[model samples]
Target chain A: MKILVPVKQVPDTATQVKIGADPKGIDTAGITWIVSPYDEYALEEALRIKEKQGQGEVVAVTVGPERAKEALRSCLAMGADRALHLSDPAWENADSLTVARALAAVIKQEAPPLVLFGRQAIDDDMGAMPAQVADLLGWPCASWIMEETISEDGKSVRAGRQVEGALEIFTIPLPCVLSAQKGLNEPRYPTLKGIMGAKKKEIKDVKAADLGLAADGAQLLVVALEALPPRPPGRIIPGEPAEAVKELVRSLREDAKAI
Target chain B: MQIELSEEQQMIQALAREFAEKEVKPVAALLDAEARFPHETVKRMGELGLMGIAVPEAYGGSGADTVAYVLALEEIAKACASHAVIMSVNNSLYCDPVLKYGTDEQRKKFLAPFASGQQIGCFALTEPQAGSDATNQHTLAVRDGDGYVLNGRKVFVTNGREAAVALVFAQTDPAKAHRGISAFLIERGTPGFLVPKVEDKLGIRASDTAEFVFEECRVRAANRLGEEGMGFKIAMGTLDGGRIGIAAQALGIAAGAFDLSVAYAKERKSFGVPIAQHQMVQWMLADMATAIEAARLLIWRAAALKDAGRPFGPEASMAKLFASEMAMKATTDAIQVHGGYGYIKEYQVERYFRDAKITQIYEGTSQIQKLIIARHVLGAR
Candidate 1:
């Protein structure tokens, strides 16, 4: 099986996202970029599925500006067999559908048996790409997959997903899309040796035009991005354990009102 | 600066962290409290090629770079400082010197088994009276025709009680002083050698630092690491690499402490919100994060310089000095952040605090590192 992992480079989760002066995005300067947390899960799951099935190649595919190469390089360092960088300036402000369409066009050329993506981009919280890509490719799809097992002969995979207080399992055929969620096997960091080898591995690039792609099917356009409201300063009410518990319950009921 | 780790280093980092988190952390307190050598973990580390990370493949080692060694050591230290020290002495002190200065035959005989993890190795340099002043070695090695007769006592030797091979340093000629030192490879079964005592320490008890006596121990002349007077250079060189390992270990301890503190700050609510919301708490976390990053950068810089075959003694000393100090501050602050829970062993920050103190003491004291840096800066003899 040739597995494709669609990745996105986002500010590290440790970063405090700052609203850009342009009022449409987070300030990018000095912010460390990491492969999306969920994409890490997706890449790891794909690698595991490949390893378990005896033999297969895991390719990470990402559509972004030049700097997205860092994401691809990191995935390659973590033992991805190869990488495909879909270069396009048009992708910067493009909607989820545009990304899905671009990924679909590029992935079609490689023609892998399976494709994986994060359930959502934490920055945008738009969980639309995986379904859109599946639609474009006319393949079965599974979302929010937390657990997975591949069948014998590498013909199909069974995935377990959490859906609104219920667990849903899907046995996706060999050729399908999977959007990984939390609780997948823990992701592995690229080792020193892996990082060195990645430098030598061939990273192929494909233009959006070459892949017969454009932003025609954009489902959503981000406008007027806003920062999360500043959290209230903490107040420490020192007391005994029982008193502390009682005080906490009272505060939850009276102040936050969620209880 | 381009801060990319090699693929092998990345894998080693992941593997080391996984192995440490899963296997070592669970037993760390038990081993430290019992002061028992982690024989099983040591064997596992050997299986993973951690025992001889810098020893070339020709000597049955993993042939990894210095950065890879530090990365692995950091992970191990994050799990258990004792194991980290054992690993540091093996790869940086004992095996590395043999590979660098030993004759080809010496490398095969002395380095192979240790690198393969078939036998553990220890370095003996610190005498009862000397540590930072290693030149004051009181151990004596007398020329006896075809061999050298050794007699001396070395203290604070990590893995001393259990090691199968020891790179023993001694004053070969008292008249020549520091230049008179010589290194000899003493096999474990050598009749006259004995472990006189094991230290009861505040931390890293599981590693077994011991005092060893060489009472007329005899080794073949061919076992000498270099020329009779070259021991000082060899010892200093070994420490140049060893300091980097220690720095990495310190960084790991600090990082571990910082990580736990952050989690606690986010989850442990105080008055009306999680402690993380308090500006004071946030400032503490921010400082911890910044310190860790700075130390890591310095550590990596030293490793990179060493890998590039540049002069790194001053930088390595700086890294060790800065990182160890950073660890001390970070671990202490971590405890403060945890308040009552931090003082108790039930929370891991206390152990981190205990572990952090050693980084400032061993490999080289932070003060000694300052002297080294001063020497480099002032061109002091």
Candidate 2:
């Protein structure tokens, strides 16, 4: 029972995001790239499932350029048994659908009982891969999954999402797509033994051509991007306390329209 | 010469930084205020293979070199200096010597568990009389049948109260001076061993400084490290490596304080603008950055030398001397940058200021390092 996990690298949450000279991209200078936060939960859940079964492998796959190998390496260090890297230059500028095509190819080849993804790649917040890849693989998709239980024989899963103070539950058969949410489980840091041994673990190259795929799928086109303007300073509603309250209410209903 | 870190080193650094920032930093202030030893985190460190970073996996270690060890240590120190010293003492003072000098059998018992951080270990060399003159020994170990009966009072021993093993130095042949000293691995709760007192420290209070009393403590001959009368040499060799670790620690403390000062300067306003806009504050930050870089380079050179199997005693000494002094200066300037807010405990630069002071005094004092450098410079022993 192998659980396949697809991950994407994103700018560290702490880094200041600056729009690049190219409107479609971001400034890469001095940016510290990290495995996306929710994706960490996805990989962590895969590892947990393998450990719970006591006899299984957790395979990680990533679609990115050369630097994306570091992302796969991080997964391996966090106890993934093996990794597949779609590092062909063709994948570098691929849209979400094309990346999903590569992932679906790998998932089909691996034939894992389950495939997992972060709800969204934080870099772009697209959250498009799970549905796109599920359509490609002809599998049921469970998005924003918070809790899951595998049936005794591991043929199906009962998944749930927290919504409006209630659990929205669904039953999906094995060989399905599940996108992880924050409340799923806490991710563990890479242990010393894991890091030392990660180098010896396998990360096989996965060429785009080998997957019978071309980077041509574009369901959505991104236009020019601009930074959000800095917020203006708050204005003081002056006068006596009672008059100030009257003025604040008038401003909220009129100029601000916040009330 | 690729000055950039290798992938492995970066991984180690990231792991350590995460642990430090998420786990250690949150509790650092409470640990310092309470002066409680960080037992939980220390045990986890052992589990993480931090206690034996340089020790090989075959011997229950990370199988990393000194560079990785320093990188990890500096990260921990940047969050909390107490955790840094706890790690440094275990890695350089205890596990390191045992791995280097102990036989394969001794390594299995003495080095393995300590390196894995299952149990704490301490170095027992400093006595009340043997402060600067480490050779002046009052403790004595008399040869008895298959082992030696030891009697000694060792002071200022880090990790002493909690340690499972102690690497003790005593004069087996007093007439031979420093040459007469022999090192022994003594386990806690072995008949006559006692921890009489734990010291109240000025800084790094989360770590224990204890007084160890050995009364007719019988140690097995197999527990002895290296040849007889080789204790002083082993101690010196161990301190050389220990100094490099301390140098890295000092660098982290300074760097950590500098980081705080920078953030504070950017936020703290004076005369209707951020203090960072002032040239005086900028100059201070620039000086701290320059000093930290210098200290880091020195530590790296020494660590690289050690990894490449070269003599690095004088270089280690230089690193310790310069880095410790730099830490003191940087932390002080950090406090100044914070103004009255720095005086408060919540601001944390005061804690850094206190932690930085010990880096100048412990492992080997900055003055003693100067002596070692002078001796090396004159081509004299």
Candidate 3:
């Protein structure tokens, strides 16, 4: 059995982002890139499945520029058997549908028994790639998956997904797609041995053209980016406790009109 | 003249930083307050391959170079100096010499488990009377049949009570003095071998420093490291590398204290403004930053030299001397920056100050390091 995990490299959420001069992208200076948190869940689930099976391969696939290899290397360090990096200058502005199409092309070639993705990339939060990839592959997909287990014969997968404060369980046949949610599983830090071994592991880079991807066209385009509004200054309520409470209530009810 | 870290080195640094911040930092205060050894996190460190960072992979180590080891050590020290010393002692003091001098069988039996962190190991060279004068070993190992009968006491043995194995130095021929010393691989369960006391230390309180008494303790001849007269040479050579580890630890302590001081300066308001606005505070911060950078360069130079299989003894000593003194000063200034809060345990700068003192004393004292460096400079033979 083979499990494929699609991962993305994004600026760490803790990073202080600055809008680039173009206003459609973020400035890359001094920003540390890490594997998207949700995608870590996907990779962890895939690794767990491979371990449970006792015999299988976990292949990490990423579509981006050269720096994306760092994310792939991280997955490899976390015990992925190998990696596939779709690298090309043309991929710089690819959209969800185009990325899904490129991933579909590679998935067709590899024909892994299971495909996994994060519910959404934290960077864009579009949450559209997994469904689109599933559509392209004509495979059943279970999104926002919190728990998962595979059958003994590896012919089917049972997954629990987060849905409106409830868990919705789904059983999908072999060769299915799953988008992992936050509560799926805790990801392991790569061991030092694993990190060393990862250096020797194979990472096969495929060009965009090799994956039958075009250079110019993308279905969805990003136009503008803006920072969130700064928080308003806090006001201190001063007086006796009873008087302060009265004044605070008066301000909330009358001046601020929050009440 | 390139001074850039390799990708592997950078990866280990990042991993260690994350581990130190997440695992060690959370429990550091509790461990220090209780003076309790962190068995759980130590085990986790072994599982993470930190226990044997530079030992060969075939010998159950991470197979990293010395540069990687120092990088990781510095990060660990940044969060908790207690954890840092335990890791440093294991990697540099115990595993390094064993790998360098142990026979293949010895490597397989002794080095593998300890380096992999499945078992713990300690170096028992510091005796009650033999602190700075290491050559005056009183422990005797007389030849008896296929092994030797050892009798003496060793003090200030780090990881002593907890370790399963020990690398002990003993005199085989009393007349030869330092040249008479021989190294032995002694197991914990060996008869007449006991860890009689665990010291209450001023700093690095979370680690166990023990005294071992060997009363007719028998050790196998095959367990001997190098040769009978080669022990002093082996010990000195090991200390040369060990100094690098200590330097990194000192560097980390200094860096950690500096970081806290800077943060405190920005947040602490005095005279109606943050203390950072004051020129005096700024001068201290600048001095600390400059000293730390200088010490770091020295450490890196020593580590790179070791990695390149060059002579790094004097450089290691220089780094140790400078970095340890810098740590002491930086930690002291950190306390001053925090005022009364730094003097207390809650802010934790006091702990860093305490930990910094030992760096100037151990792995050959700052005085000893100067002597070594002076000897190298004068080309004494």
Candidate 4:
């Protein structure tokens, strides 16, 4: 049995993002890149599946430039059997759809029994890649999966997903796509042995053009970018309770116009 | 020469930093106050392959080099000096000498479990009268059929009460003095072997420092590490490597204090503005930072030399001496930077101050390190 997990490298959520000089993207200077937190859930789930089965290979795949290899190495350190890095200059500024297409091309070659992904990359918050990839592959997909179990024969999977204030469960066939949610499972830290072993593991690189991608493959484009405005200072009503209440109501109704 | 960390070293350092911050930091103060050993976190460290960073995978270790070990130790010490010393004694003091001198069978029995973190081990060398004058041994190991009957006392044994195995040094032939000493692998719970006391320490209170007494305890000849007369040489060589670990621990303590001082200086107000605006405070911070960086460079040099399989004794001694003294000074100034608050337990810089003093005294004192360095220099001349 083989499992394939698609991971992305994004700037750490705690980083203070600065607008790039070109006004097109976040500044890369001083930004530390980490494996998307949601994607960690996806990888963890994949590893758990492999462990439960007693034997199987978990392949971690990614689409990015050279710096992106760090993310792949991290996955390897986390006990991924191997890594497939799709690298090319054409991948720069690629949209979710373009990423899906490249991933679909690789999935066709690998033909893994199952595919996993994070519900969304925190960087873009564009929860579209998993569904788009599933569509391109013509495979069934269950997003925001919180629980999963595979049948004995490995022919089907049952997954429980978190909907708005409700639980939605689905039974999907093998070779389907699944997106991991936050509560899926806790990821393990890479052990010292694993980190050393990762250096010796094989990381096979593929070209974007070979995956049938082009510079014009990106369908989404950002025309402008701006930082959110600073929050307004607070106002304290200094008076007796009744008078303070009256003053607060008046400020809310007239000055701030919040009411 | 280039002084950059390899990617693997950087990765381990990052992992250690994250572990220290997330798991160790929250409980450090509570553990110190209670003097409770962090068994859970130490177990987790074993799972993360930190317990045996430099040992080979075949030997149930992480197979990392010494540089990586020092890097990881520094991060752990930054959070809790107790955890750092516990890790240091296991890696450098116990497993290292066993790996170097023990036979293959001995390695499997004595080194594997400890290196894998499945079990703990300790080194017992200092007796009541044998500290700086390590050559004087009051412990006796008389030859008996197929084994030796040991009778003696050892003081200041780190990880003593909790360890499953202890590498004990006893005089096999007292007539030969220091040359007569031999190292033996003694298991806990052996007849007549007792941990009489667990000391109440000022700093690193979370770690156990015990005293051991053996009365007619018998250890098999097969358990002896190296030849009978090779004990002193093994002990000295082990301390040379152990000093590097202490240097890294001292560096971490200084860095931890320096971090708190910087944050306190920025927010703390004196007269009209933040104390950071004062020239004297700025100079103190500058000095602390400079000393820390210098000590870090020295530690790295020693660690790198060891990894390269070169003679690093003087370098290790130099690093330990400078870094230990630097930590004492830095922690003292850190308290000064914090004023009265630093003197209080809640500020935690006082704990760092207490921890710093031990580094100057253990694994060969600052004075002893100077002597070793001088001997090397004169010998080379």
**After superposition on all CA atoms, what RMSD does each candidate show versus the true structure?**
6.3, 1.4, 1.8, 1.9
Candidate 2 per-residue C-alpha lDDT over B1-381 given as tens digits, one digit per residue, 9 for 90 to 100: 668877888999999999999998999999999999999998888888899999998888888889999999999999899999999999999999999999999999998888888987999999998977899988998999999999989999999998999999999999999999999999999988899999998999999999999899998888899999999999999999999999999998998899999999999999999999999999999999999999999999999999999999999999999999999999999999999999999999999999999999988888899999999999898
TM-scores of chain A, one for each prediction? 0.85, 0.94, 0.91, 0.95
Best by DockQ: 4
- Off-target runs (Cα >4 Å) in candidate 1 are A49-54, A118-121, A144-152, A158-172, A214-217, A227-259, B1-87, B103-121, B129-152, B161-165, B170-180, B185-196, B213-224, B227-229, B244-361, B364-380
* Segments in model 4 whose C-alpha atoms lie over 4 Å from true places: A235-248, B270-272
Candidates ranked by DockQ: 4, 2, 3, 1
True-vs-predicted CA distance for residue B48, candidate 1, Å: 7.8
Docking quality tier of model 2: medium
Error of 4 at A215 (Å): 4.1
What is the per-residue lDDT of model 1 for residues A1-259, given as tens digits with 9 covering 90 to 100? 8899999988877787788888977789998777888999999988887777668899998888888888898899787999988876767778777888888888788899888888987766778889999999999999998787778766788988889887798888878888988887788655444555677787888877788766464467667877678798998989999999899999999998979
Name the lDDT of candidate 3: 0.92
User: Cα lDDT of model 4 overall?
Assistant: 0.93
lDDT (tens digit, per residue) of candidate 4 on B1-381: 788999899899989998998998788888899988889998899889888889888888899999999999999999999899989999999989988999999999998888999888899999999998899988999989999999999999988988899999999999999999999999999998999999999898888999999999999999899999789889999999999999999999999999999999999999989999999999999999999999999999999999999999999999999999999999999999999999999999998998899999999999999999999989952
Q: How big an interface RMSD has model 1?
A: 4.8
Where does model 2 exceed 4 Å of error?
A215-217, A242-250, A257-259
DockQ of 4: 0.87
Report lDDT (CA) for all predictions: 0.87, 0.92, 0.92, 0.93
